[model samples]
Target: MAISEPASDQRRAFVLDLPQRLVCLLDGASASHGRASLLLVVVALVAFLPGFFQISPIDRDEARFAQATKQMVESGNFVEIRFHTQARNKKPVGIHWLQAASVTAGEAVIGPSALTSIWLYRLPSLLAAVGAVLLTYWTALVFLSRRGALLAGLLMASCVLLGVEARLAKTDAVLLLTIIACFGALARAYVRPRAERTGDFRLAFIFWTAMAAGILVKGPMTPLFVGLAIVALAVVERSGSVLRPLRPLVGLVWCLLLVLPWFVAIWFATKGAFYQHAVGVDMLGKVTEGQEGHWGPPGTYFLAVWGTFWPSVVLAAMAAPFAWRARRDEKVRFLLCWLVPTWLLFEIAATKLPHYVLPLYPALAILGVMAIERGALARAGSRLAGLVWLWPVLAILVSLGLGGAYLWFGSGFGLAAWPLLALAIALLWMAARAFPRVGPEGAVLTAIAGALVLYTAVYQAMLPQMRALWISERLAAVVKEQGCPAANVSSFPYQEPSLVFLVGTDINYVLPNEAAALMKKGGCSLAFMDERFTGNFEKHAAAHGLKYHAVATISGFVYNGGRLTAITVYRSDDAPAGSGAAR
Candidate 1:
């Protein structure tokens, strides 16, 4: 009985331990899942936030946006976008509003003039990028496993174009946020039965709200893109009623309610001029003609996408065939409906900016992750196999070539270029080993990680040097150093908006004919003109009784990879003789 009693005691101990062990296992899994979620967030911040404010404001778009936000803060005009008293009605007020809010908040902390802090202008986009990444994870989880969700988030967060847009004060990053939100709601609405969907109106609410927000971000293109995807899904599913649960009438009401207030206010303020410029010139012009010299063949975006997506491009490309083959599957079908039509629309559009197709990338990332989860890459010895090997091969070669070029030609990078080369080599080694065994997820992560490292090194080492070469900030500073009053300086023939922000006061963008007269009427007026137009300015100056001498020769790349412009700074001494007659 005593021996029997010992065995019974042992059995009781085992029984008690079993549930505890299960509880511990559950706890561990929950903890691991939480950590996995955090990993992507950390990766996103690392990808986006570092050196974000370190680089000078990029010219044209970024500077234009910043200046508009500055105007919003100064003029207290929350609805209309303006640049130095000129209405910029092309884009919606969403990005400018957000930037204004950031500037306002930043100024409160750092004093009123702190609106000039470029990071504040860019913060919304960074947060939006992080939001987009998180939303992609959620969308992936709706149809994918936990690992797939993480991978999708990482892939989108690390994409080159997305990252670049995120770091800028551009509309695309925020536009992406609204896009993912709308798609996320669409994914949710589609997954549930029609009967069950009506029980929860939250999804429809989310979808409508996001659509309206997106429209605010970039005008009708947002709705057009999302509506086309929704329509495509309905058609492909052969259920015209697939969108029934969304209740288009109700959603439209919500969209109009959210978007109308500002649109109406701006229209009234500008006396319909806003619509004429925005819809007529900016929006319609892009549709009918290549606005802003961005014309390209239909395949322009298709070719550009590979480089934009980069490190993940091979897997994404491989995933397409498999994705198409499995198009009958509900999630795959939804992704196809979401990705293909929108992608085609952008490709067919008259204007082709790299960021125009950004809204389609989350779907692409989800599809790429689905392929990995489905063992598609494993079957092919992963993305590292065959001609896919050329990706890393070319990447390494490019890295080496760029590093050599920097060493030989570019200034300020110095020995720092070699670290980028090392990163490329490490990526190659990882790809060679991991792809065949660990598959696309592992190989792609290695590549993305290496790319991030390379970018950080290059940006840190080269941004200041690049800024010196690209932005007008240094030239503006030089003007300030020379005691040129902000109001007394003007740019001739060209209005680089960056000069407005960097110079700290509005510099008039004067016409060639008007520049000479203005200089002659004002004492010691300073004019910054492109070197190419010096002869034209000299002719006008000689005729207008303005004696001008080149103050300094300031040369730099207009922007990264843009034209190399050497601007001659000229200080004009007014003679006042027959000056007003020339005007």
Candidate 2:
């Protein structure tokens, strides 16, 4: 009852032909830089925009970054960094300045109400992610065929980590764009012969300027990634000749010129506390041990890349043989030098975040496509043939995992996601079946079809519907619906940065007794008392003679504590005891 071999072969050919045509179409498009660049921008937007406007402010990092930016917008303070009364001394002011500019532009063009829209804060990240894709293509062009470069950009546009970074208002996405810009210029200069490398001033400007921008965004990281690559290449080739093209001495002074003003300003502003915290504590502490519980052993990124890099990660694995054989090639060695040393350093570092190695992903995508170009990819009977299943199998597993999350946390199966889910899986299955005829390169293009669809489903459909996971959003909505949008709230036990961001800056993070005291003073006062503090709140309320009761209860998972939390919001309309003043 099985299908005939000829019939199956025909089916495989039809499936393979589509990806083949896609590859050809991109190659033709690459003939026109405008056409290719526009295509990459479109791809990046499609990959990044599905949940950009819909998802709530993520806690810990994204919300903290956004709130600090908001404070900058309000206070008109461009240099000093703060989160409420506490100084956010960890990072430089570049991102906050960019985010402030974004919010200001939104308010000016879109309306004053744009100040509160979370998407406005994330606009920089989305644009930066798109810029990184284009830069990836530009960087790959120095070594790869135009088609291969386009493919690399497409892979970056479709990556899981980039998409995540694009949606959040943080430094990583912007940092990524700068890093790739550095790579684009450095890769160009590195692959040339030492004798011909007379240091083009333009390339040096781009490299050092990009490095400066990276420093302003995140201290030390840009130099660390770029410097490590420079050092590694010098050590590997046993010569400092390659460094000539970058014009090291003059470029260093130019880089310092761009960054020193801010460093000097911040030093004077914080009395040197900024460097002590940003360098001595935040940076080094992360190297020695995990800060904020983001700890992982070595090789964590190797496993995380399967999901983080998605479709192209499988192809990158398939390209290992080619990478080994071509390790000595000028371009290949440059890429490996760019990728390996920093990667190993991060692996050795005690602090490990998934995005820590994101700047290196462009190298992986280029290598994968290079393998495909050289016909070194997996064939039907090849040793890497088993990896043909990795893409499709991972696609299915990740889809099921996300769909399960939607069902488990959202109180029901996400019915709206059914069509998209089926489409994604069906395309992946087709890609898997075509592997024998099309090979890894074509198969990656086909698998990306599924990945793009899955991204849409996960972000636009499933993630937005998981309301319980976004507790701060619910709290904000309830307060607004109760006609107290500007109510002063005292939140206890569940003081996530997202709550501080969504509810307002004035909200006090306090214990039950203090929350009760705050509510006793005036009208339009609110308290989000955790269930654990219910008794204490009631005791304090009785003592203060404050007539307040829980209007609504919110239940959700708190990411920081990794536990389910239940908080009851208490509202009050009482005036002060003696004044009888109505609010």
Q: Candidate 2: where is the Cα deviation over 4 Å? A: 1-10, 378-381, 485-487, 575-583
User: In candidate 1, how many Å is residue 237 off?
Assistant: 2.3
lDDT of 2 at 355: 95
Give the runs in model 1 whose Cα sits over 4 Å from its true position.
1-33, 244-248, 381-384, 397-410, 521-524, 535-550, 559-562, 572-583
Per-residue error (Å), model 1, residue 372: 1.7
Count clashing residue pairs per candidate.
0, 0
Instruction: lDDT for model 2, please.
Output: 0.85
User: Considering only N, C-alpha and C atoms within 3 Å, which residue pairs clash in candidate 2?
Assistant: none
Name the lDDT value of residue 168 in candidate 1: 92
Q: Rate the local accuracy (lDDT) of all candidates.
A: 0.75, 0.85
Please give each candidate's TM-score.
0.87, 0.95
| Model 2 lDDT tens row, 430-478 | 7777777766656677888788898898899889889889999988877
Model 2: weakest 10-residue lDDT segment is 574-583
